[model samples]
Target: MKNRTKELLREGKRVLGTWGMLGDPTTIELAGIAGLDFVLVDMEHTARDLPTIEHMARAADVVGLTLMVRVPDNDPKTILRVLETGVQGIVVPQLETGEDAARAVAAMRYPLNGDRGVCSITRASRYGALRPKFAEYVESADRELLLVGLIETAAGVENIDDILAAGVEVAFIGRRDLSGSLGVHGAAEHPMVLEAQERVLKAVAAHGRAWAGLVPYRKPGEEEWITHDVPFAVYRNDISLLLEAYQNGVRMLGRESASAHGQGGQR
Candidate 1:
């Protein structure tokens, strides 16, 4: 029943996290140690298995980081697998309409709100330890566990109002993918992309739901999300950060070597 990410949002505090695309528990642990509020394990674009998510969720729990996972799609079975691991939130990708968002919500909730299959013998129910208090757990999980919808397409932008009405607690409009959907490819900064982002986010905020975005490292454009009053941001993924670090090291060495050669006068 502990959800630090939701608590932070309720407390009017900024919720910062990084993507866990590497499928390593250590990365989730490191994010927790680094003071992140959550770690969103990526299953949409990664080879992360269900057991890997369970392990990462375990690491996140130990470190007090709220564990969230992006399911490959809005499938009940997919959502069920992660929830069993005691993960606190679910993110459904390529969410395009209210029906899609509603389906995702129903996949996570227990009836009479949703139809998610029940099993108290799972980590989320304390391996049957909370079996006696299963009803309470169900209520708490339904009330607190976040249901996030990813808006990454033109259709999503057009239907944002409906999406919000469908009970998506968080609307994370992914600009990178939205850019591609809008025919901009990698131009997340294109006017069309930025315009659609603002449109969807404005609707998300207006509907009294939290909004999230991916902030680019060292880009002034990244600050727009903050200034626009977004409460959640994922500061790049672990893989991207590592790649940048390595690339920087190589660039530094090359610069140093070039400078030394210039000073040596063609030696």
Candidate 2:
């Protein structure tokens, strides 16, 4: 499997993606159809289990979408389970130290780059069909996996340099959680939160690493982040978009119907 997302990043292109937090393969497929470069299947904030994640990964593969997963934690089993499903990479949450980052990366790769368990029977290996070329596959996968480290906690930000050195390809600022860490719950736009985010961005840039985050769709400040050197951005989550679209559609149709009825009464 090829990691198109990593290829885009290597080309110095901004890769746009969306969140597949609804635990539905359909949403992941839709992101692919919409021409998104990737979709992050979230296991951190959702109830999605291994089977559901595997299904989403397969759907993404079928639709030619680059699939990455946000694992719930740095547990070796959790990371292995997600990667074995054939996703292109993983976003490890709440990573606070260099050791944490290193462990996460190790769990993503085989013994060549790291100590990830070897199993050629996985979908990642084309279900053992690629066993003949197993060595080559391991090396390619180790190089191509887009391991992203999330800097959402105070400790993570403080140890940002160490985390960067631990071989993560991207440093994603989780502003919502960072806000909580900064003592302001859910205040992602608060000054402290923005300042903390800037700190993380500066650290990433100084380390010569790429950065990513979720952008507010209707907000006017997206240009600021782009200018600030955030090359990867997730537009929104499937659940949030679905909710907004459904609510807006209902409201608009209701208004139009009411206006039409009033005009008919005038007749």
Candidate 3:
């Protein structure tokens, strides 16, 4: 299957995707069927383990959905292990400086370049089916794999320029965490958040790299002026989207029932 995320990135078009915190293979499959270009298996806030993540990655691959795993920490072990699961990319969070971003890239590479240990029989190498040409696969993995650095904190924003120069293919703006660090938790539309986001975009653009982010909109009317030059966009998470729809449906039904009862009493 073609790497849709890479294709979109190369084409300079915005690739839309969302977070998959559910950690269920079925949920990941459904998300893939929904036509998202990619789905991030969130290990930071989710209870997903290595086995579960591997299952999710397979489901995504079956449906041609690019799987990107957000490792729990910036640790090298976590990064390399997750990559071995055949995920197309890695999203390293809480990146505070250029060195942090560089370390992530190094962890995802092999020796003589980085420290990713050799694994000729893992799922990433087609479980030894492609082992004969392991070197070829390794080279391709280096070119195809995406390294995303998530800039969320005030310090990260301050060091944005350096982070972009660290050879990160994409820099994601973690809006919620960024807002919290700026003392405007959940206020993604605040002037402070807007300014920080603009700074990140400018820095990323200057470095000729792509930027990805999520826009939190509670209602239809809230979708205004969010169009930036972001080449990747994650609209919402699965749980939040499900909860919002359920709430709206329940409220609408309740209101309809109340209106019917009132009409009958009047008659």
lDDT per residue (tens digit) for residues 44-125 in model 3? 9878899998998899888889899999999998998898888999999999998998898889888766878888888888
Runs of candidate 3 with Cα error greater than 4 angstroms are: 216-225, 255-267
Better of 1 and 2 by lDDT: 1
Give the total clashing residue pairs for model 3.
0
Clash count (model 2, backbone only): 0
Clashes of each: 0, 0, 0
Error of 1 at 32 (Å): 0.8
Q: Name the TM-score of candidate 1.
A: 0.90
Greater-TM-score candidate between 1 and 3: 1
lDDT of 1 by residue, 57-172 (tens): 88988899988999998889989988998899998999898999889989999999998999989988889998888899899989889987889999999998998898988888
Collision pairs in model 1: none
Per-prediction CA RMSD (Å): 5.4, 5.9, 5.8
TM-score for each predicted model, relative to the true structure: 0.90, 0.89, 0.89
What is the per-residue lDDT of model 2 for residues 49-96, given as tens digits with 9 covering 90 to 100? 988888988899888889999988898888887888888989999999
Overall lDDT per candidate, in order of appearance: 0.84, 0.83, 0.82
Task: Give the local distance difference test score of model 1.
Answer: 0.84
